[model samples]
Target: MGKFGIAFTIAILMVACKEDPSAKEESKQGFRMTDEERNATPQVQKQPEKNFRTFTNLADTTFIRLADFSDGFAYDLRYATENNFLKEKVYDCAECYTRVKTAKALLMANKEFEKYGVRIKFFDCYRPNSVQYKMWAIVPNPQYVANPKKGSIHNKGGAVDITLETLDGKELDMGTDFDFFGKRAYHDMTELPRKILENRKLLKETMEKHGFWSTRTEWWHYNLSGAHKDKVANFKWECE
Candidate 1:
């Protein structure tokens, strides 16, 4: 009786030691990696650095040029026009460049405005870090330039300065000029003419809905969110 009991106990123990067939198969199929094994695996390399050129805004001078789109405005209009604006600003962040594309999309979205002949007029876009440094050196105004250490959103290629005009080409009186830096540009609902103020509101609301935000000091300035927040290599785009 003792020998048989011992034999039966040994057989039961062997059966218990055997792994479940389904679990064994699953363990073979599932992902398994030791820390060293994971460390040994080569990680994907990042994309090669983008080649970029340098471009300086001519308006950086005292003789303010009305950007190309500011047709009637006496300011020198060099990069202000549609044809030249994008190339005017350097593309520091490939991702942030979507702001320009979004602006164009906004224009196309308002097709009815096209019938009325109205369109967005850009004053500036994508300023290079060097140009920003130059501007800061000249003015050194915090109101205009964020600390170079913190960097301007423009430096990241995520901000734009723009205005609106009629299809027949009448510029909406924005209560203040593009670079004006006072209370007038504050999006004051009570100060401007109902129509003009309403126009400002429209521009702000439209741009905000499209992932862009306006600064309090400059109604025309809008920064696209999550675009190129890092300091890119300082380079300019050359005219073709």
Candidate 2:
């Protein structure tokens, strides 16, 4: 009777041990992940393949797409949209093209801004002289739009309209919106809050360090020191 009882107890214990998968895994020194968990991955965007041209052979005055050089910069390209002061689209499409010298300086300045948790957000970049005429036809004011006949530094690919934006795309207050024609938009205006002044100062000072100078009338406008000599280009960029 005792031997049969012992055999029956051993058989019952063996069947009970097989019920738990986790206990089996513990014995095997492993764990099992659910199908969903095993396949889970963090979402990431693949960077576009760059076919950028080298700056070495290009002249300082050569025109180039700023995005071709670096993806770190941001662009608004207001003239390419109706949101600008003109209330009409002047550019065929939005693109930031600048002289080699201007692009080089901006790339460097943006790298510096990155250290401060900011980056440059362009409203406008190089302006074809013909687009200047289009803007003039809309505003036709020297204070607002440059005269097409004489041309501005923008026509020479030496100028850019920009502002500071946090790395997450939050725009810093610069007292007024881009192309706001008033004393508030003036760089010398100090009626603004300290935060606005500091933001503007950062932009102006860093640009100056990069060989760009600010215009007195528009806080967003800047010109490369020696880019006025380049011919005023009338060609426009292709949009697809």
Candidate 3:
């Protein structure tokens, strides 16, 4: 073949070898699109593989990272930083873990919350018993922090501290921040603005419908029914 002909053939082969962008998008969203549609739609960047873990064959009481099972939820994880009520960084890394049963309940509750245009945004979940001690040392008040010797439902992997946020990540007004430790944060606090009360009611009622109950004093805290029966656990997650 002449040099011109050989160069033309090589260019065609290179084009055929290139990966299809639509195929990558299809794998991420589980929907296929034609070339024209792909060109018109905006691209969504994929999150890291750590968020895609599965729960196959996992036991109901076994602890699993919540992010691995769903992308619909958001996390703030205040204890991983010094921003919490304790004003101390108690965790080496920010991670949300819960028992399989509790995670299942949360997934269902979040779906319901989505109908109202909001979803669960977690502050804490499945805290280690060791970390509970750190919190107790700072704020020994049982009204604020559970006694480490008694071990809270969080240590049992059945409780979560969460709030609601819009699908686009705007936080719903729930009257007070996480761990406010005041009457203003109470579930029975009705003196707040109409919007704040409604937001708290939505969170509390939906969680109860999913077999979780809220403490009267903490609007952001929820415990799965009977989760306190589970033993206190000191299982710590590995930090990268």
Tell me the whole-model lDDT of each prediction, alpha carbons only: 0.58, 0.89, 0.93
Highest TM-score against the true fold, candidate: 2
**Candidate 2, residue 113: lDDT:** 94
Model 3 worst lDDT run, 10 consecutive residues: 47-56
lDDT of 3 by residue, 1-240 (tens): 999999999999999999898788878989986779868968799886654766689999999988879999999999999998788999999999999999999999999999999999999999999999988988898887889999999999999999999999999999888988789998888999999998998999899999999999999999999999999999999998
Segments of candidate 3 deviating more than 4 angstroms: 1-51
Per-model TM-score on C-alpha atoms: 0.55, 0.80, 0.79
**Would you list the clashing residue pairs of candidate 3?**
none
Query: Residue 63: error of model 2 in Å?
Result: 0.8
Candidate order by lDDT, decreasing, is: 3, 2, 1
Q: What is the lDDT of candidate 2?
A: 0.89
Candidate whose lDDT is highest: 3
Model 1 per-residue lDDT tens digits across residues 69-165: 1222112132333233223432332222223343343434344334545666656656667766755665677876666656777666666677778
Q: What's every prediction's RMSD, in angstroms?
A: 18.3, 4.8, 12.1
Q: Is candidate 2 or candidate 3 better by TM-score?
A: 2
Scored against the true structure, residue 170 in model 3 reaches a CA lDDT of 98
Clashing pairs in 2: none
Q: Clash number for model 3? A: 0
lDDT of 2 at 144: 74
